[model samples]
Target: MSSSSSMNKYWIPHLDIHKKVITQELQFYLGPEATVRSFTRDGEDGFLITTPGACLTDEQIDDICVKSKEMWEKQAAARAAGAATRVLKRPLHQPVVISKAGASESTRRRRESRRSNETRSRRDERRRN
Candidate 1:
C-alpha cells in the first residue's frame, strides 16, 4: 500500500466547518482513503482534502459542485426571506406621504392648524409683552 504522504491534495474553497458533525459528514462522503484538512487565509477559511490517485471521478466532482451551488442558493434565499420579514416587522424610520398633484385633505388640514397655532402663539406673546 502507498503511504499517506504520496496522496494528491485537492483544494476546495469556502469549505469551512466549525461543527464536528459537518466534518464527520464530509469525511463520510469523501470515503476512507480521503483526508480532509482545513485552513484560513486572509480571514477566509477553506479545505484541503486529499485522496490517493485521483479517487473522485468527473461525475462525482460535477455532482459535488451542483450540490454545493444548490446549498448556497438555499442559504441566500433563506437570508433574504429573513431580511424581508424583519423589514415588515420593524416600524418605518421615516414615514413618507406621497400625493399626486396637490396635498391630501388631511395634510392640508394639518398645515392650516399649524399656521393657526403659530399665529395664536405670536399674538399671545405680543399681548404678554
Candidate 2:
C-alpha cells in the first residue's frame, strides 16, 4: 500500500463543504501538524485527513483513535447546532388559507374590511376617470 494509505489516514467520501471552511476549522481543532485536503478519485469527491504523528508517543495506536473520536464528536455537535440556527433564521411567510368552516370571527371581519376597501377604491377611481 502507498504511504498515503497508511493507518494514519482517514477519508470522508461525502462532505458538502463548498460553502464551508471545514478544513481550516478541523486543522485548528486537531493541531497544526494535522493535514486536511480534498481529492477526487473513482469519479467521487472526497476529503482526506492525515493524522499528525509528530507528537505521538511510543504507545499503542488507541490513544490517537480515542483523541480523533473525541474531536470529531465535538465538531459534529457544533455543526449540528449551527445548522439548526440557520434553519431558525429562515421563517416561512406563506399566506394563511383556511376553509370557511374553520374561519374565526376576526378572520371574517378582516376579509370583509379588505373587500370593502378594494370596492371603495375602485369606485373612487371610476369617478376620477
Candidate 3:
C-alpha cells in the first residue's frame, strides 16, 4: 500500500482468512461506520480498516509517519546498545548450602537445653508434691 493510504487507515497485518473474519467482526462490533479493505504491500497481504469520522490531513499523516520512524529508530538503537553491553556468561552452577543429615549443631544444642529445663521443672514439681 502507498504511504498516502496508510495515513488514513489503521493497517492490520493478517492472512486472507483472518482479514475476512476481522473485517466481519469489526463491522459487526463497530456498526456501518467502520470501512474494511484489503491491501497488498511487496507481495505481503494485510487489511486496512478505516476509523469512524477519521479525516487527517496529508501534513498530519506525514508528521505522524516521521515521528513513528524516529521513535522506532531510537528504540532499536537502545536495544542494540543494551544487547552489546549485556553479560551472557553466568555462574557455572547455582550456589547451594547443604546442611548435614538430621539436625544442625545449633538446633541439637537448643533441643538438649530444652530437655534439661523440662527435667528440672518436673523434679521441682515432684519435690513440692
Residue 113 in model 1: shift from native, Å? 8.0
lDDT: worst 10-residue window of model 3: 14-23
Best by TM-score: 1
- Residue-level lDDT tens digits of model 1 in 1-129: 458788788765554233233345454566677766676656677766676756445565555666666666778999998988765444766566677545687788899999999999999999999
TM-score of 3: 0.34
Top lDDT prediction, candidate number: 1
For model 2, the stretches where C-alpha displacement exceeds 4 angstroms are 1-7, 53-129
For candidate 3, write residues 1-129 as lDDT tens digits.
234444346665543234334544565544566677887766777666675546434554444455556666777999999999876576656566777655787887898999999999999999999
lDDT values, one for every candidate = 0.65, 0.60, 0.63
Report the lDDT tens digits of candidate 2 across residue range 1-129. Answer: 225544376655533343134454554555665676787668788766677443223242334445556667779999998888665443576456665554676788899999999999999999999
TM-score for each candidate, following the candidate numbering: 0.46, 0.32, 0.34
Q: Is candidate 2 or candidate 3 better by lDDT?
A: 3
Winner on TM-score (1 vs 3): 1
**Which pairs of residues clash in candidate 1, taking residues 3 or more apart in a chain or in different chains?**
none
Of candidate 1, the 10-residue stretch with the lowest lDDT total is 15-24
